[model samples]
Target: MVLAFLTTFLATRFVTHAIRSGRGPFRDASVGGVHVHHEVYGIFLLLGSGTAEFAYRPGGGWGSLLAVLFGAGAALTLDEFALWLHLEDVYWSREGRSSVDAVLIALVIGVLLLIGANPFDADRSAGEGVVALTLLVNLCAALVAILKGRVVLGVVGVFVPLVAVLAALRLARPTSPWARRRYPAGSRRAARSRQRFPPGRRNRWDALVDLFASVPHGTRPRTATPTEPDPEHTR
Candidate 1:
């Protein structure tokens, strides 16, 4: 499943890059003069695969096939995640960076699970009630982390409870929901948060994002004619 998702993501990015440059034969898919986004196909694939799995409950190779289909569908859908997120085509825009982030998070989590990161498993030495309480506490910490805008940490912390507690105890991002509610204007923590995370500060994560999801304002290799619609603005 991971392999399928990774392959589809790479292929989709390559095709989109080609369309942006008008270099390869790859062009945007359309139907009856209306632009057809790849997510539409992904939605169908997801539905089909899901229905088949539930109804048939196949095993072995059949189950593997369905998983592959589901993974591919997920990749296609997530590639345009920023589009659905903003209810507009944000592809090639700064907002589109979220799509890459989402894909990476999902990929990392999936790999972690495949490699045996099971938070649900409890130690035999610990009582069930203790395990349940611990799980609840970890979940609350995770929620706090997410609200604090430590999204990657919050999500990953679900599989590693210590990370959740650490994230919960940290300062919230200036624009995060937690900060907006708790860190009033001119507050010390608010100022500290801003100071730590200065605006327009390009970090390693930003560089990684730009490497995979370059925006129109960046150094994207494209030179569309004035008469033609800028490919950067299209899917």
Candidate 2:
């Protein structure tokens, strides 16, 4: 799965760059005068692979191949997730950054799965009750983190229960539900959270994202032009 994802991602990026730079004969795919996004193909692949897996209950080599297909589909779909969300050609806009974030998140989750890190780490000798209890506790922690809007942390924490617990206990992002409801405006807790995640910190994070994601030039939000006062009003 990891190999499939990386292969598709890199190949897509390379082709896109080559086309953009006029170094490749390849052009954007279109039909009936409408541009076709790769996500369409991705959706089909996912559906086909999922159906094949379910119908045949494929195992061994066939199962691995199906998994690869699914991963490839996931890569293509997530690469244009922001376009689906905005229902526009935001592929080269600031909104496109979401696609990069999604890819990174998917990669992290895939790595965790590959590592075989189980969330429910109870021993078989510990009995069924103990195993169930452990799973329940981890689930609750993961739920709390997710509810607090630490989605990435919550997802990754599923494989590391302690991380979920810590994230759940920590202050939520300033704009998250937990912060808005639990840390009221002007409250000390809110103020502290704001300090921790200041505007500057967000800007720095954005810089890192741009650096890693290789965001296209001119995609950043444009500054609004300042309007001059009317001559009559000024006089």
Candidate 3:
């Protein structure tokens, strides 16, 4: 219960902080086939955590801990599902191929999480351990996908953390190199490099970093106002 509240409180506060600091919320270009409004996303994550902890039931050995973990995971998965239900426009803007690829990745990982000993259903003592371990694995997988430009893959990678990790990665991953380069200053890329690659990569996040790094900084796309603020504010 406390963890969920803290997480939600911290996440919400962070977004508020970003906005106050002049980093107002912006739309995410990699919406693929689903859209997630940032406001609602935070609400659900906070609620999910609360519900999961409240639903926790004690059990023997690893059973008790697993109960709490599953409840929590359920809360998180519910939050992720909400993203799919609420936002279609942002999720589907990319190439058809990327959307399809993301679904495939989700299916594969979802199956893995559901099967393979079912961490959520483990003995209570082992459940906590299982949840923790799976969370680690999920985090590693998500990081790998983000660096590789697999936006959909990264989004789907959060199953273990009830999609929290995936959400976190989305917020953390650079939206565009141009934006980042400009924000920090002194990090500008040379002009000759900008011409070699397209401005927006297949995924907005990738293109931003890749294009900026490959081409000169001046030629990159200006950070347009986002259509909807990013739901995964942690990134």
Candidate 4:
């Protein structure tokens, strides 16, 4: 299933980029007057695979086939994740980068699970209350990290509790909801956060993300306004 998802995602990205560049025979498909997006095909594939799996409860090779189909479908749907996220066609806009982030996050979690990382692996000897408490603590820590704008860390913390705890302990990004609401304006903590994560700062993750997709993805031009630098999303 993982292989199928990765293969389909790579192929879809290649074809879409080729079409955009007019570098190959790949072209956009349309039905009547409406242009069709690849997510449509993915949605159908998911429905068919899911329905077959549930109705027939197939095993062995059939089960594997369904899993592959489901994985491919997921990749397709998530490739346009930004479109559905904002209820608009932001596929080539700056916001569209979220689609890439979504795919990367999915890939990370899927691979982690495949490699035997389990978030629910509590000690059996521990009482149910202990297990429940641990789960709650982990959940709260992950939520805090997310609110602090450590999105990747928050997600990873679900699989690794320590990661979430550490992220929650760290200072929130200057633009994060947590910082905006909790840190008073002009406060020392707010100033420190802004200094730590200045606007337009780039990191290794930014380069890694750009490696998978084209830059400028048809981002809309900004209108004339204050010349202040734009804030960057801390991936």
Candidate 5:
């Protein structure tokens, strides 16, 4: 469980940071991405731990109950995470998510601490303790990130460290940026030309295109030719 949570924490963190620091509203995108990463990896963590506990211990004792409690705790955590994610998805979704999420998180933490404080077989309990610790760490990091305006870091903090490392590797690869620049120079110029207009009735790209095309290549406007004189006026 510890391994699982840590894995998620690291992976989530790296991704969130990458998106936050990238161009545009990448920060918001990063938050959404981190939430996704946590959901995917967090499930694995829960499954692996539950399996391990069942395989070796072999009975529905207090130990099993503890494991079940943790599993439920994780489900609650994810639900709250999802609520927050939805709130971020639409502006109106935020009305009650924060308050509800806080309560859910507090309950998860309480259960985790209770399980950790109980006496149990040292080896197995150690694993459970580790899992609990991971959740706690993730929770604290997320709160800090939200309060400090670095919510991406909090989202990323839910993933394992390896994901973050991998993200860094991908960023450092020359092919990543090179691929993005594959568009022709003319297209690039066109893209830049379109940015002047506000995104209103017309599509944003079209507006930009219109703006760019309207500008003369050289600095001067085209001069109009003089019309031929009328016969009556000339006479």
Candidate 6:
């Protein structure tokens, strides 16, 4: 899975850059006088591969090939996910950065799974009762972390239960639902959380993603404003 993901991700990035810079023979697809986004083909490929995998249960080489197709489809579809969300072409906009973040997240989870990190610890030597208890505790911690909007911590904590407990106990992100509903206005905890995880702090994560996506500065779409008529013309 990791190999497939990286292969597709890198290949897509290369092709996208080549097309954008006019260095490759590749060009944008169009059909019936309408420009077509790769995500459309990606969606179809995902559906077909998924159905084939589920119905026929291909094995060995065929299974590996299907997995590659699935990963490629996922990368393509997610690359333009922001466009689908906002119903506009924001591919190079700040909003499109969410897609990069999403891909990074998927890559992290895939790597973790490949490394044999079990969140449930079911494979351990503990008895059934102990394992059940541990699972219950970890589940609660995971839920708390998620509710507090610590998604990365929550996800990683599943593999390391202690991490979840620590994250859940920490103050929630200021703009998270947990903070909005629970942290009263002007409260000390709210202030502290805001200070610790300020909106500006997201720049660090954004920078990491920029290393991959290389978004140009000042390309975000601006809101339109109504124009005023000239006073002399109105008179």
Window of ten residues with lowest summed lDDT in model 5: 170-179
Best by lDDT: 1
Residue lDDT tens for model 2, 1-235: 8889878876776665554444558666656545577888889889999999999988999999999999899888888878888887666557877876787778888898888876655564378788787778877888888877787788788778788889888877787788888988999999988988876565554664575356334322322224432211110
lDDT of 1 by residue, 1-235 (tens): 8888889988888888767666668877766546688888888889999999999999999999999999999999998899999998888878999999988888988887889987787775287888789889999999999999898889889988999999999999888999999999998989999998788877776787777797423335445555444545565
Residue pairs with backbone atoms closer than 3 Å in model 6 (clashes):
none
| Local accuracy by lDDT, each model | 0.84, 0.73, 0.42, 0.82, 0.39, 0.74
What local lDDT does model 6 show for residue 35?
Answer: 56
In terms of TM-score, the best-performing candidate is 1
Q: Which pairs in model 4 have colliding backbones?
A: none
Error of 2 at 49 (Å): 1.4
lDDT by residue for model 4 (177-210), tens:
9999999998999999999999998787677767
Residue 174 Cα positional deviation in candidate 1, in Å, after optimal superposition: 0.8
Cα displacement (angstroms), candidate 5, residue 143, comes to 24
RMSD of each: 3.0, 8.6, 16.0, 7.1, 23.9, 7.6
Clash count for candidate 3 is 31
lDDT of 5 by residue, 52-81 (tens): 677776555756654654554354345336
Q: Of the candidates numbered 3 and 5, which has the greater lDDT value?
A: 3
Error of 4 at 180 (Å): 1.4
Q: For candidate 2, give the lDDT of residue 188.
A: 95
lDDT of 6 by residue, 142-206 (tens): 77887888877887887778998999898898888889999999999899988988876865666
